[model samples]
Target: MTENPGFLLTVLAFVLVIGPLVFVHELGHYIAGRIFGVKAETFSIGFGGTIAGWHDKRGTHWKLGWLPLGGYVRFAGDMGAASQPTAEWLALPPEERAKTFQAKPLWQRSIIVAAGAIVNFLFAILILGSFAYLEGVPRTPPVIAMVAEGSAADRAGMKEGDRILSISGRSIGDFEDIYRIVRFSPIEPMQIAIDRGGNRLSVDVTPGVLVERDRFGNEYRMGQLGIGKPPAVYDDIGLLEAPLVGAERTWGIVRLMVDTLGQVVTGRRSVKELGGPLKIAQVSGEAAMMGWESLIGFIALVSINLGFINLLPVPMLDGGHLFFYAIEAIRRKPVPVEAQEWAYRGGFALLVSLMLLVTFNDLTSFGLWQKLGGLIG
Candidate 1:
């Protein structure tokens, strides 16, 4: 309720964060449909009972809903934006059927379905690129300032004044990259290339366990190389080069996310790291508290995440729709309607299961169960 400050902040942050992303995604679909000559019937920002709405010049019902969880856009002949043709859709006169989504050619349909995710990725690129243009690219050179005595770096023959060039074959852009990699990889040893004066040498270092405390008085274990970087410096970024730098930055996140998913599939990563709405809301609230710049950066990261996740070729996703289109293209005809229904059903179930898992993970992250146990014990 609104009386509970923390609770209200979380809810508000969740709505604020999810609202724009979903609006942008649906806008992509809506715009693409208009470009391709499909009539959009309704553009709603949420589900269930409508709170406020009006008809537009284009004969589209634009409305806000009471539920703030998710949103959709329904075209003239779409059962929904998923664009599956239904019996009602089929019952339309031949003249009316011309405006239906299924009437569009395969290529157009594919583009429309994929537009939401593509726009999300583009949003991230623009956000990051703009930051780069204004603030410049971080070029900290990864030089070590001091190595903790008898710590992981010291034990691995690392010395002070060493300039790190790369880790595990990946070039280190900044000191933060080193921290992220080290923190994520606990068991793996890092093969690092360094520049010592004029000599280029390599070293292998296993990260040591470092217990840390957060503002919440919560304890966490992160990997420690026991090495610190020198003062920060940034590269001179031009307006033209800013977007390219941003794309490169976005690509890095995409690669990391993909690799993380691969690790999960291979059982090398814990599924508990998966975050749903609750985790997102918490992060959003934290970012909001931090300041506007932090919140903007968080939004950019989430946009990239939304794009990447939607592009995964899973059922009940944008990628899933595209997957069926690919099959249809190859088969020279649509997959049977019965088969599609079954596939969508399966996809919905998969999504629901993932939602439940991530919600449980969020609860655990919040220490809800632990607090309850403490109460009971």
Candidate 2:
């Protein structure tokens, strides 16, 4: 496809990636609501004007809309994100509001909110594990897969299949460990210990810095060695074992995110790494071009991210709702309605502001404004 069409295709691809994750997320809420006997008025994807939908026997309106950004599951008496505690809620004759979310027990509310995120995570894990079993899990053996022509490793006479035992003085357990060291300390010259056919060799190779795009269109400067595997061996496992593997992989990514954020907080990692929808769109398009496997892998990662982010203790999010539930559980009463309203407003503002900033970053990263300026000039 032409580049212009590619952009459109990319948009569709992103929707594909995002839509299913969101559906799975909202499905969790839907399921939980049904289980708890909470009334659900609408189950909609996208927001705003409903383009198409249907009414189920249970009176739930399942619809799709023109906008494709995100979706929501509206429970009975949502009162919107910034729900008010009007006399109507209190004067609901008790029995009526009992079916509403606001009237649910603290534990039930927590479960309903927490379910969405949990489902996203579960979906990611299952996808990952299935891929692992199908593809025989690619593993790097702490060995050099290839050396870029005329690159540092080539200059140092590094050969393929040379097992990397150590970098500087630190031991290397896996090829990934070496990658982490190189990316984290790109500029530093390091000593390497290699194992070649039962022979030990030592050399020094300075990793070169290069810009790489992650699955989410975010660009990062990291050490590049210009090497990768053709296809590594995978530890075979049965169907029953795949799901656990997937869950473990999902957890690994979660741990990496936590670690990266910790590093960012400590000023060791850059905030520029933070990406938004634009980045996701760019990456989604790129992944589509790469192949189905790559796209699926990217989707899984994004799904995991969505799950983890929603679990954050920010207002208007599943985690944030759960936070209030926790307080209710502890205090034996809900936090004041005024406090919840203000908290949601603040959270919504923060979310919108962050989106704007990330979009700006995306525009800059893509040189969109620069190209436009050149056209004007």
Candidate 3:
């Protein structure tokens, strides 16, 4: 199993990673809808071509689709396809259109739609925070964990367990500080002061440029000082602290996502680097191979992506719907149905196009496209 080829590994990875994360996301919306009395017609685990399905007492159809990329919830009178009314719904007079989604208050409708993405972010934070608190964060204490063989750090005589006291006379705190210095440091000679063998020593090493990928697929060269991180000493806290830490971490990730988007919009980053489902599956399989902890970590990471994606100000998405609500709140009436239709059409096209591009990139990155090219060549 460990030696399995890439295609099988990628498929299994997609199932494990995308499947549960998406289910949890849709679950958020489904539960919120039920709580708020907005009848859901179907809760599906994928898009297009249902593989299996069952109906519930609440008149909701649960389904597993043949395609495993993504899922959706069909609400009663959802203003689009994917739903059908039961006899009871049809039996109701025109005057009693209460159970329809359109009948719900704008605020309630917004929350129900937004819950899926919100829950995804919350899930990420909670999971990461729990992991952090449980095992303690891996802290590279101004100290080297492991020096990579023949790397810059190893060549500079940086040994495992050697605590870096300073860099160019600036005192160091934790591993992050070292990373900051190393990642952004100019490719020039720099002095590093370390406490090795209980004695302080200073050595000069030149930072080297290494290529790395950002969350977006853009590659950039950055300064590198190769060193691994050691496990932090676990310091337990009250139950309340865990959630707080989780929330802060979640917010930070959200901020990072927002910043990345800004960079893309500002032309400081490449939009083509944006990854879609295929890339996620590849990452998931890679993470899974590392360990359960790594897989769970990837889940937390993707949860953040799910949350942010839903918040896009495009119609048919949670954020897009919210944007309409905002306009309604300002104008004191719903946006014209025609306007919404146009917006949704545009958004759907943009989303679909983006998906196609990312899928292509994913295949290309996995060498699938390259292999096909080779066969033809």
Candidate 4:
């Protein structure tokens, strides 16, 4: 496989992208545990059988696993990666129990559980901030340079040289803002405020549906106004302001994700739009080919996604642990072990089903079944 440069690059890119994110996630838990005087029994990158391992001076078994999907940090009382408490560890001597995760205070345990996702978000912020600080931020004015003939913008009486003031009552500061609003509102009527030659005017426009395909043959459907913007100007951002810019960008992505998920749930979007590891690998390879800046940007984007997904209130995830903690906090006691076990079991099954669905989508997107059928025929 190493001899095949393209194949090797793809594999390498996938590892490079996933490995650090997983490590950072686990590191967040490990660091939080250490801060609370909790003992980490093992810190492993990846899961299942160990490919290589060693014991650290702090009695932490550090290992690289054969499976490179995800990783975990097992505290003293944790029975598995999900951080379920073990009977033996719980029954240990008082002195030893004090150093176990389960023995920690409710607030401490909640922080420990939530640390992984928080760290992922922080990682993305740092990356994005650094990019903005170094390369400056792109600022494109919301001025229409062109309107497609007979398209939505043209039919709505939108003309070139018009400066967009707002959409749906929301202020528009940049051309990208217009794209963001219009992209999610295909065929939806919107009241757009514009300034034409210093004359304030309001126009009603319905965005047209636009379908696009990437080099990988993946399809994307979105709304378009069929309007063009002038060239963007790069504005140098201050060191302090860079992080704020990054945070805003991160929030924007989260909002988009939330909107997309809502659309999917409302049957406005197809479930086929969901992607899995295969899509990540493909995108990683493509980003790598586009140079370090693009690849690093993609990493930041993926990191935000990882953080967002982990923070979801689903069982067997970081958010799930926090959910249980929330319940424990309110009840003034932990939930029964049996109830937790059943919940975890259901969560596991749900996760597995989702994985299978996304994998099927990935395969279908790649036309794998069609190719196999052609061969069989």
Using TM-score, give the best candidate's number.
Answer: 4
User: Ranking by lDDT, best first?
Assistant: 4, 1, 2, 3
Whole-model lDDT for model 1 versus the true structure? 0.83
Each prediction's TM-score versus the true structure = 0.88, 0.79, 0.74, 0.90
Clashes of 3: 0
Per-residue accuracy of model 4 over 1-377 as CA lDDT, tens digit each: 11222777888998999999999999999999999999999999998899999998989999999888899888888675455567787679999889998788989988998899889888998998999899888789999999999999999999999999999887888998898878987877889999999999999998999998765555677899999999988899999998898887788778878877877889877899899998888788878877889889999989989999998888899898888889988999887878887888999999999999999998988789999999999
For model 1, name the residue pairs that clash. none
Better of 1 and 3 by TM-score: 1
Local distance difference test, per candidate? 0.83, 0.81, 0.77, 0.87
113: Cα error in model 4, Å: 1.2
Decoy 1 TM-score against native = 0.88
Output the lDDT of residue 103, model 2.
Answer: 74
Which rank order by TM-score, best down to worst?
Answer: 4, 1, 2, 3
Model 2 ranges with Cα > 4 A deviation: 1-5, 80-85, 91-95, 138-208, 212-219, 223-231, 375-377
Per-residue lDDT of model 1, residues 261-327, tens digit only: 8768888768987889888988777777767787888988999998888888887788988998899
Tens-digit per-residue lDDT, 14-61, candidate 2: 998988988999999999988998889999888889899999998999
| Backbone N/Cα/C clashes per model | 0, 0, 0, 0
Candidate 3 positional error at 329, Å? 0.8
